[model samples]
Structures are given as structure tokens and as C-alpha cells.
Target chain A: MNRTFGEKVFNVFNLLFFLVFSIILLIPILYILQQSVDVGAVKSGLSLWPSDPSTAYYKMVLGDQGIYGPLLNSIYITVVGTTLSVLINAAAAYPMSRRDYKPNKFLVYYIVIIPMLFSGGQIPTFLVLKELGLLNTLAVCFLPVLASGWNIVLIRNYYRSIPESLIEAAKIDGAGEFYIFGRIILPLSKPVIAAISLFTGVGLWNTFTPALMYNSDPTKYTFAVKLREMIVVQEDMSRQFEAMMQQMALSSASGQAMTNEGLSAAMMIISIIPIIIVYPFLQKHFASGLMVGSVKG
Target chain B: MERKLIGKKKGGRLGTTNIVLTLMVLPAVILLTIFHYLPLPGVAIAFAKYNIGGFQEWVGFENFQYIFKLNNFWRAFLNNWMYVALNYVFIFPSSIILAILFNEVRIRPYKKFVQTISTLPHFLSWAVVGGIWMLLLSPSNGYINQIIEALGGEPIYFFANNTTFPLLYTVIAIWKSVGYNSIIYLAALSGIGLELYEAAAIDGAGRWKQTLHITLPGLKPTILVMFVLSFASILNLFEPLYVLSNAMVRESSMVLDTYIFQSGIMQGRYDISTAMGLFKSTISLVLVLASNFLSKRLTEDGQSIL
Candidate 1:
């Protein structure tokens, strides 16, 4: 329990380094939060504190019909997409994990592993989506991402670790495969399922290119695609703010003042809020899930 | 006689269980065939003359030849490898160093606080991350530039200046990923026996000496496996580059991913673009196979990491 002078110095330095490093990491997010509230620093320079703090930016982001369409699209896509992905991955993984199943080897190697190694790349995949008439639809957001080799592999590994005797006992009791999978395996596999759903949900929520590539219609854009347009593609976010203000003037309150920086910050934070809320609860699962995926199949 | 009996029982039970399990796996197979397997054959478009409408003609190796001839293709190809090498030098070991640092922390609550804040950025999409960095690095009124001006130094245009663009991009990439990547190393580090460190300490080993002899050597196998695994998807780094790059830094930022997207999707040069994609995929597959082979040779159990 005794420490040398060098050790003591190292500890002090480490603490200060992390203290500063943590602050540096948080600055962007903190700056955004501050900008979202403070109207006074709209045009320039970092503000440590909000001068004219208001909730108007949040209201603009939340209430505007312009943002609503994309928000609904994102919510529906993430919900449905994640559910379908988790279900399909679980179903696929369960069967593939069964040692007695004849096709398990072929399914694992040929069907899953081969595709993981080689892909037709962007154009071919885009073409396939187009051929299937999935382009420009909300379904495009989730359909192509429904089954991933990595997710299946992770889930299958989890399934493989489940005691085989449990399934055997169920089979002895005249339980069908579907019943065993639905009743026993699904419940037992909650941890893996939660992990997959959390990742898939986040991926779907942050989905950009699929929405960007497939959905040309402004009405069909996901929150990510819409936000990209608002913040990145269009240099002049102030014009969008003016348009929002005009719409607000007609729809609700007319006198409220909000800046482009405030609006952009609010938009970024709103998009990230779902993740922030869910992450703390499921972080351990995410870490464990990553390790599981990294393990040899 | 026992083997025959077991085979007979298996054959008998295969009827119902196999049918239901096959049915369960059917959806995935169908979806994979449509989405993943189907695109594989679509790589053939790289060899053909194609456009938005359809395949125009069979142009054997012409597209590949054209891609090879283009200076832009070579530039992107080189830039792609440069990024990978730079990642090896800068980005790859960052998480390991961070994990080691985290292990050094004695205060549990502070450790958790720092770790949580660090990992938050990983959840954000490149689009959002890009937006945040753009604001933070903006030349006119960016906080970084403001600080530089306050220090009586000239503000450098990070994204616009080709010289600073790659460095800035690497820094941003590390910031976003270092926390998340550290999770794996941290897991590995926790598995290293505390008894070894205690023994070393009892033998009059200092903290630095213990780390060098016990900690790092314990981490070696995990490091080896991770290194090989990383090679498999080295070319899969598209999203970050796509969201971050601009016209000004095109000279530095145009890697194979952005090249393929630009030529194939944006410009509708499907044939040449598909060729570029095929080239990228082929290299990625080679890297994957090579890494798998290396991992088998390197690991104690002689197992492939991928």
C-alpha cells in the first residue's frame, strides 16, 4: 500500500490529464447545449454560459411540421426495423446454432460467412434495392439492413452457449421446435436480443446513406437525412430558420426569436436524446455484445 | 453399432425439428439472398458497360483497365492505404493506451465518469459528429480558432487546408472511437491476473516495471487478435470520411470509398464505379483471408480470429 514519489507524481499527472481530457471531449457537446439556449452568441465565438437562455429553440425543433415528418419516419423505421431485425436474427441464429440441425454448417459457412467476406459493393446493392422496388420508400430504411452476418454470428454464439440439455428436455416433453424457440430460447436469449436490438436501433436511428440514396422525396427523409440537409449540406442554415420563423408566424407565436445556431444545436441534441437516454442503461450489454462478436465463430 | 443407432435416432428426429428450424431460418436465407448474395453477382457489372438504364455491353476488363489508368483512381488508392497505415500508427493503439490508463485509476467514480463521457460520441452518427466538428473547427468563429486568436497565433483552416485536413480528421476519428474501442482492450486488461502484479510488487518491482513486464505481455494475445481482425474491414471506413470530407480537402480526403460513391452513385458511372468497388472488395477479402491465416498462426490455440 506504500507508494514511491514517482508513483505519486504519476498519479497526480494522470488525474489532471484525464480531468482535462474529459473536459476537452465534452466541450463540443456542452457548446452545443449552450448554443441551443443562448441567442446572444448566435453569430460568433464560444460562450461559456448562455446570455439569453430560452427554450424557444427546442420548441421550434419539436413543434415544427417540417421536422415532424422526418421525426415520424425515423421513429417508425427505427421501431419496425429494429423489431424485424432482432426477430429475424434471433430466428436465424437459433436454428444455425443447433448441432443436430443438418443445414446449420452450410447456413453458417456458405450462406452467412461467404457474404461477409465478399460483397457486390454499393452500386450492386443499390441496384438490387431498385430492382425490388424498395427505392424511395420508408421500407428501404430497414429492409436491406434486416439481416447482418455479424449479428447472426453473435446471436448464434450466444445460443450455442445455452445448455443443450434444456432443449433436449423440452423436445422429450413433446414441445415443437417453434414452441421451444418462441417460449424457451427467446426468453433465455434476452441479453443477446437486447444487445442486438440496442445496436440495430441506434444504427437505424442514425441511418443516413440509405435514406440519402433511396429517398429523394423530402417528405420521406429520415431525421438523419433531414438534419444533414439542415446542418451540413446547406451552408446557409439561417435561411431555413427564416422559413421556420415564417411558418411559426402563421401557425403559432410570431414574436419568438431564435438563431440558426440555436436551432441547429437543438436539432442535433434532439436526434441524440434517444441514444443518451437508452445508453446508460444498456452500456454493459453493448460492451459484452462487442466481446461476444469478437470471439471466434 | 452405437454410432449406427445414434444416426438412426438422429434421422428419425430430423423430420419435425429440421422442418421447423428450416422454416425459422428461411426468412434470413431469403433476405440474405436478396440483399447480400444478390449484390455479389452484381459485381459482374464492373466488367460490363453499364449506365442508369441497364447494362449496355460486355466490356471484359475494360472498366478495370480504365480505372487503373486514371490518375484520380491511383490517388484515391494511395490515399486509402495511407489512411490505413496512419490508422495503424495513430488510431489503433490509442484504445490500448487508454485502457491501460483507465486500469491505473484508483478512484472508481471518477473512472466511470470519464469513461461514460468518452463513450458518448461513439453512439452519434458521422453526420452529427461531422456537424459538431464543423462548428468546433470553423475558421471564422470556431472555439478552436478563437483560442488560437486569443493566444496571438494565426488561426489555421483545419478542413480547408490540405496540410492540416488529414491531421484534423485523424484527431476527430480518434476522439469519436477511442472510448468505444477501449471497451475491448479494457475487457482484455481486466482478464490479466492481478496476482502477477502483486507478485511483481512483492519482488520489489515498481509500477512502471510491473506494467512493462506483466501488464503489456498479458495484453499481447488480445492485441494480436485485434490487429488481425482490424485488417478485415480496413476498407469499410466509408461513413466517417464521407460525412467529414469537403471539396477543399479533396486532394487529401478522396479515399477509395468516396471515390466509389462519387463515380458510381453521384455521377452515374456505374460501370467504372462498380469496378472501383470490386477492386476495393477484392482487396478487403484478400486482407480478411490473409489476416485469418495470420491469426491462426499467431494465436495459442491456432484459431482464426475472423
Candidate 2:
């Protein structure tokens, strides 16, 4: 473990490099956090430091039913979608994982190759949903996410970690395949299940594209779609911001200001905070899941 | 390999395992068929003229012909290649450098902290990341512009500028993905034998010499795999640009994916959009095959970068 002078300098440089880079990465989110709480009529806007801190923006954002609707929708989609995704993919993967399953190669090739290949473009996918009458319904949110080929691959690989004799022993007994799958395979595959659930949960929580393409209704929007909509209306908000800017120019004292940029930041915070809250716990599984999934490939 | 029967249950008619397996795979079969396989037939819609309920007429390649002539399509076409080129020049190497630096950290806890912190953006949806960056890059009051103003320089509106657009695009692309992507290189690094490094150290090789000669060469296959795969994704530059683009920046930012979105959804030119989608998908497959071929050569053991 002894280091030469050059190695010592390199270590110092490496630490500084990460330190500086990590700060560069962090400042935007940190600024957004600080900006969300600053009172709208600060007279001076967009400082690194908040001039005046208050809960006014939070109250205003919280009061709007626009924010709450999508908040609930995103949660509903994520919870339901993640649950169904794990179930469908895991169930499908269970058969593929068993070498004794007659169609394992056929099923794996069909499902796994789809992930490796290009997807049928967004338009056709959209049309399929529209034709199905699933568009603008909450079911649309979960449909595309229902059985991911990637999660199936991950779970199938995880199932390989279980002893082959375990399943054979169940077969030696009177246990049915479903009985063994439910009783043995699933319970043993908790780590991989948790991993896929975390990955799927993050994906569903942040899903914006399907919501954007399929659902025209605001009520059907997820947190991601809602977040974009709030930012997209900056043009409309800009007019109000111009008025506020002029009012600040005129008044020597504090003036009433509408939530413009602050509103979007608050929404951004809302969209991200739930993920942030859950992220630390899931971090280890996320890394291991990715590694396990890719190591064979 | 999968031909073996589990037990002495030899009945071909409705065996318990076969039935259970069929029941298990039914949902995946149904879902994939409906969503994914349908696109194969639905892609035919690209050739068909539009109507309310179904096809109006068979227009052959007219939809493809139309998009080729569109001004917006050309702009996005060039932008896609430009993004691909920039990713090669900028992102591909920096990620490896990051992985190397990360590997160099002697402090375990500190290394883990940096790794975890850097990958934080990967976990969040682009909508949230895009919003944060949009504010940070705002010409009026964004922190970047604030820095420019502090230095007595003019505040540049990054997204709206063609000159700065690519630069910001590259930085944000790297910022969002480098940490997560570097893990691939780190995995490659970890896969190298410790004895090689130990022998090098014993033979009076310094850390730099050891890393340059052993570690980087160990990562060569991975780096090339990433390179070839990314090269194929040049036209695939939709996600990042889709979030950041505005009408003003569409000239610089209109990728094929967004063009498809604009045509099909916004303009109701579903035929043209489907044509574009088919076009993109075909090229993507070609690129994937080419990369797979190249990666098989590099890895020397039939590796697929999927």
C-alpha cells in the first residue's frame, strides 16, 4: 500500500477531480431546491442563494389540484405497473429459466431478441393503443410496461442461481409446476425480484412518452408529463413574468408576484422528491441487477 | 438443452409442467404480440394513405418520398449525424477516463460515495433532469448565464444557439450517462487479473505505466463495443433533444424521433411518421448488425453488446 510521491499527487488529483465534477453535477438540483422556496416577488430573481426563504411557493403548488392529480396518477401507474411487470415477467421467466422446460430456447430467443433489436417506432405503438381503446385510460400507463423483455431476462438469469435439484425434488414429490414456482422459485428469487421492481418502478414513475403520445387528457398524465407541461407553459408564464418584472421596476417596496419559474421548480421538486427519497435504499440492488443482467451477455 | 423431461411423467397429453409452462408464458406471448409484433404489420400503415378508421389508399413509397422532401426532416437528419459525431469526439473517451479515475481511488467509502452520487441522474426521469438544466441554462437568470455576466461577457441562450447547442447537448449527455456507463468499463477493469498488476508493480512499473500498458488495454474491447454501438445510435438521438427542444431550437434539435412525433401526433401525418419510423428502424437494425459484427471481432469470443 506504499505510494511514491507521484502516486500521492495522482491520488490528490483524482479526489479533486471527483470533488469538482460531483459539485458540477449537484449544483443545478441544489439551486432548484433553493429557488423553489424563494418568495416570488424577490425583486431580484435567480440567485445562487435565495434572498428570502418562505413556504409560499410550496403552499401555492400544493393548493393547485393540477399538481395533485398527476402526483396520484404517477403513483398509481408506478405501483400497479411495477407490481404487474414483476408478476408477468417473473412468471414468464420462470419457465425459460428451467432447462427442463421444453420451449425455453424458443421463448428466450423471441423475448430476449426483441430487447436487443429495434422497437417498432412510436407511431405504430401509439396506433395499437388507440385502436385498443386504451388511450387516455389509466390502463395505458401499465400496458407497455406490463411485461418487459429485459426484466424477464434478468429474472430468468436469477432463477438459474437456484439449484436444479431443487425443482427436480419437487417433481419427485407430487408438487405441480405452479406449486414449485410459487412455493420455491419465487421466494428464492427475492433479490432479483426486488432489483427488477426497482428498475421498473423508476421507469414507470418517470414515464412521460406514453403519457405524452397516448393520453391527450391532463387527468391521465403522469408526474413526468405534468412536469413537462408546467415547463412548456413558460411562454404564457413569461408574459406574467414580464409584468412582474415591470412591477418590480416601478415599486420601491415588495410587490405581488405570480408563481412563474418558481412554480416549475416546485413542480420539478415534487416530481423528483419521491424518487430521491427511495433512491438510497435501492442503489445497491440497482447496480448488482445491472451487473447480473449484463455479465453473461 | 431444454429437451429434457423433469420426471417419469411421460404423458404427452396435458402434462402438469407443460400446462403450467404454457399458462405462465401466455401473458408474455399475448402482450409482446399485441404491442411489439403488431408494429411489423402496423408498419404497413406507412405505405397506406390515412383515413378515420382505416387505410384510405395504397400510396406505395409516397410517404417516404414526402418526408425526404420536407425541410424539417433535412435539418433533423443533419443534426442527428452531428450528435453522433460529437458523441464520438467527446463522450466516448471521457467515460473511460472517468472509470479509470474512479478505479484509482484508494479510499473505498469515498469511491462508493462518488459512484453513487454521480449515477443519481440515471435514476431520475429525463423530464425532471431536463427541467433542472433548462433553468440552469436559462439566458435571463440561469446560473451559467449568471457566471457569464459575472465575467462581464454576454449571457448566451444555450438552447436557442446552434453554436452552443451541440456543446450543451454533449455536456448534458455525458453528465447524465457517464457515471452509469463508466460502470461497464469498471466491470471490465475488475475482470482483469490482479496478478498482472502485481507482476507489473514488482517489475518496477509505476501506477501510470501499469494503467497505460495493462488497465487501458484490458478495457480496449469494452471501449470499442461502446464506440460501435454508440455510432449506430447517431440517428437515435431523440430522448435528450426531445426534452430540451423548443420551436426556436428546432432547427438545431429536431431529431428523427421528434420529427416522427411532430408529423404523426402534432400534424396528424401518421403515414409519413410511420414511414419515418420504418426508415429509422431499418437503419438502426443495419447499424446494430454492423456493431455486433465489429464487437464479435473485438471481443474475440462472440460477444453481443446487447
Interface RMSD of 2: 2.9
Docking class of 2: medium
- Candidates' lDDT values, in order? 0.82, 0.79
Q: Which pairs of residues have clashing backbones in candidate 2?
A: none
Screening candidate 1 with a backbone cut-off below 3 angstroms (N, C-alpha, C), the clashing residue pairs are: none
Candidate 1 per-residue lDDT, tens place, A1-297, comes to 999999999999999989998999999988888777766534345556776778888988788879989999999999999999989989998888887777777887766668778788999998888899988899998888897777888888889888987887887798888999999998998888888888888888998888887778898899987888887644455446557868878533434446565677889989989999888755778555353333111
Error of 2 at A41 (Å): 5.5
lDDT of 2 by residue, B87-126 (tens): 7788877878898888888798888888888877777778
Model 2 TM: 0.93
Candidate 2 Cα misplacement greater than 4 A, ranges: A40-49, A243-259, A289-297, B1-14, B51-53, B224-234, B302-306
Q: How good is the docking of model 1, as DockQ? A: 0.48
Q: Pick the candidate with the highest TM-score.
A: 2
The top-ranked prediction according to lDDT is 1
